[model samples]
Target: LCYFQQGSQSHSVKHYWYTSWPDHKTPDSAQPLLQLMLDVEEDRVESPGRGPVIVHCSAGIGRTGCFIATAIGCQQLKEEGVVDALSIVCQLRVDR
Candidate 1:
């Protein structure tokens, strides 16, 4: 994942990036995607922004949907009282 941050008055510009290999056949080659997410979160907290990332895949919907849903779940957990990622994901899927 890669995000381009257009700086706001409160925060500086930053590039938050992460990569993952989903091919199960090559598990050894699969790097830690969560670690990358953590780094991106740290960067984002250090520097907030307005612009969202341009996310896509070979077939963009499924991959993008999952990614965005997960982010929303985490955000909701922080902002709201949500505790279950799976339940949030279910609601998202139903709405979609």
Candidate 2:
């Protein structure tokens, strides 16, 4: 956790680094990644006014994309009982 100030206001930023994930490969277990996602989700839900959650990897494509897709897919599944990974990917691409 870290804090910074903009003007006279201060905010917190949390960072979760996964150093074990290889550059182009997935982790052997999804548990740690899933936990991170859940933690982020909970934080967002509990703090509606918080800033966006930023996730990144070394190259900002392979692992980063996978992590984002998984997070969005899981949220969609929870709220809609289904996951549209292709649509999510397309949306993410557009945002990028």
The candidate scoring highest on lDDT is 2
> What TM-score against the true fold does each predicted structure earn?
0.50, 0.84
Q: Write the per-residue lDDT of candidate 2 for residues 1-96, one digit (tens) a residue.
A: 899999999988888787667777768888888888888888889989787888788899888988899998998998999999889999999999
Clash pairs detected, candidate 1 = none
| Collision count of model 1 | 0
Residue 38 miss distance in model 1 (angstroms): 2.6
Give the TM-score comparing model 2 with the true structure, all chains together.
0.84
Candidate 2 ranges beyond 4 A from true positions: none
- For TM-score, the strongest prediction is 2
Model 1 spans > 4 angstroms off: 1-19, 23-33, 83-96
